[model samples]
Target: MFDKAFQRVNTFEDFRTELVEGKENRAGEELIQESRKKQKVDDDKETTELKQCLEIIPDEEEVTIDAIPLAVKSPRIVDWKIHKEGTKSYYQIIRADRKSQMYMIFSHMLKSFEREHLEDLYKLVKARYGSTRPVESMDYLLWNDMKIMFELHVEDEVWKLQQGYKVLEWKLYDSCGVHSLMMQSMQIYMLVEKKYPLTPPTLSMMLERSFKLIMKVKWLISCVN
Candidate 1:
């Protein structure tokens, strides 16, 4: 009789142990599932933000060089030479077409620095325009931004020159002329670089190219970071 009593007690204790272990295992599984769901939600949010940040207008029409009207009087052949002023070196292309008129300036610098400058410009645009695409009228704003960027580049070049450092790969150009003539000259300059020798592009085209370049730089930076 005592042996039977002891065996019944032992069976009850074993059953309790098994029940406790089963509950613990279920709790652990629930925690793991919850963690996986949270992780997936976080990932989805990041992807959505990235997509919004990189949004671009589709099939936007561009004004080609051929569309621009030629100047009534051909511009005088301007002389270009490397100029050094107070630790800054740049190509100075004088516009002899008009006396005392603004001439074109070209500076060569490191491609990496150029990319960073473009990224900075992208940030400025995003801050002003948010996720909305800029309108045609807003092209002037972009041009202004580019002008500021070039000015900053000039300062940077001066600093680098002072440090006895010289870099090259990317070219920066600034000029003033009749809109059509300016566009033509710019297009010619770009084409000459590529050895294609084609026509010039409009102000809008130049802005569009700058926008695309900024986008590319931003995308590359995101990948690296």
Candidate 2:
């Protein structure tokens, strides 16, 4: 191949020579052909590599993905129950988010505290909501009737689908006095059940650990007594 290229080259030596040199005139014609073959092989190899590079590149469609729909991942149940108490309701929580797995977790958390403290918890939350008292302690539950009520409990179907939501009431006692000291009446309401994360679940998690410790001590004292 080199011999042919040399032949192809119109060098100064070619002008000096009377006759055109044939491509196979030199003894190195075999080596030149081999070199040309190697050059062709290299160019073919480069083309193959370029094709492979183009093949490996992703398409515009492959670079993009479809958007996913946001799903409700919370695990809370709505326990709608009717208000059995007969008093002018002061505060009412109306939650009707059709997308929620249940009603908002806040009511349930408050209800958990209510269930744990029963009327006491309810009054406690009510008191805290109504007044600005620093929550120190809870009396849990303290009644014999709660067991029966607990069995038929369902807050989900409590009130009808009214045009507007109703409010909760503050009940009065037999002494003609509005039940002021709710926790003081440790014989009526009791704390039996609870849910987590009312307003701040993370904060609830911390409180849960602390309450667990307190309950453990209470258990130890009861066992000893």
Candidate 3:
């Protein structure tokens, strides 16, 4: 092939002269063809790599509470009882009998507290929301109960601190209050349970509100204690 790339010389002297004239033409078009073939192979390899990259995809996994087995996921649920209050149906949780006595004691304490301070709490709520409307409902009762619980928690924490307990070192931080943090967490949990199909804006608002409430409660508890 290389020999065909050039014309044949007549004699040895002529061949030597041709060699001298074609010194710059060693390998001739064969080298150019080989280079083009190599370039094409390299371009094809690069194209294959680009196609593989374009075809690559990432795998994603989604998880939901319903996807998990009930027995294994939530073993604490003993039973549920439905109570019809007028038109609304409320589900009452009934846990193990081992907790029956404790539940009874807690209920008794709540009833006693309400009995003693119901009038006072009513007055406070009335002052907060004007005396034009009467506050005599579940929300009023819950608000008073939460306040009592908050006070009790704060007092207990203060006593613990006085006794040289290092509990507050971690519990009473700048951003969170130990007294009402649990209640706020429970509120958030309940909110999530009641509002599962929440929009991004709603979820964001709830989180911001909950965080501010928690921080405010913590600051108030610290000031009072």
Candidate 4:
């Protein structure tokens, strides 16, 4: 009888232990579920915030004008020619004059006198120094001045374009070749000033003399041969 009573006590202890273990397992599962639900809520909030941020940012390849985003168009190269004269060569290009809306809006930003001055400088450089020495041998101070002036003008023009509801498209600005045109103009100015200085007996005269000497040497060499 004692052995049977001891077996019953052991069975009751096992049942009590199983009941306690089951309660602990259920509490752990509930804690895990709560943690998972909190994580899901946090993830959803982050996703919604990311979407809102993306909505606030503009597209990379589009420019906004007058509250409307417009795609940038490729610039058209209408006409281009390379002319060779004597030992010098130069390019003449006439690009399609289809102006961008940004350009049209800011066209009047450059004053008429400034426009005339730029045109006159172009004409003077072309007419006076059409065929001259390389730009490397030109006046350094003059070249730097021209560069500074050109850069300032470009910056001012860009600022004007950026004013109001207009955003400047760099691709379109680069394709327009305005910077290239200005650089060419500056080079021409340097070359012309170097070749045909206002002072008498210019550097070009000395270069011409040196060229004549070279030609004479070549003539003598041919005769000896």
lDDT of 4 by residue, 1-225 (tens): 999999988876567888899999999999999999999999999999999888664567676557533333233434333445685544332334643211111112122213333433344434444545236332232223344334344343322332222211111122212221121112212222122211222334435555777899999999999
lDDT, candidate 3, 1-225, per-residue tens: 556544333222656878766764766667888899999999999999999888544557553445656443212324333445685544343433422112221233232232223333334444554524325444344444434443334343322333322111112211111112122113211111122233354445546666877899999999999
TM-score versus the correct structure, for each prediction: 0.25, 0.18, 0.23, 0.30
The CA lDDT of each predicted structure is 0.44, 0.36, 0.40, 0.41
Cα misplacement distance, residue 115 of candidate 4 (Å): 12
Tens-place lDDT digits, model 1, residues 72-169: 43344334334556755453333346332222232221121233333443455456556454564333334334443433343422223323222212
List the candidate 3 regions with Cα displacement exceeding 4 Å.
1-13, 20-26, 56-225
lDDT of 2 by residue, 23-96 (tens): 33563687888899999999999999999888554565456447664543222222222222353212222223
What's the distance in Å from true for residue 216, model 4?
66
Candidate 4: which pairs clash?
Answer: none
RMSD for each of the candidates: 24.0, 19.4, 18.5, 22.6
Candidate number that wins on lDDT, 3 or 4: 4
Q: Count the backbone clashes (under 3 Å) in each candidate.
A: 1, 21, 0, 0
**Candidate 1 vs candidate 2, TM-score winner:** 1
Candidates, ranked, TM-score: 4, 1, 3, 2
Q: What's the lDDT for residue 55 in model 4?
A: 64
| Order of quality (lDDT) | 1, 4, 3, 2
Taking all chains together, the TM-score of candidate 2 against the true structure is: 0.18
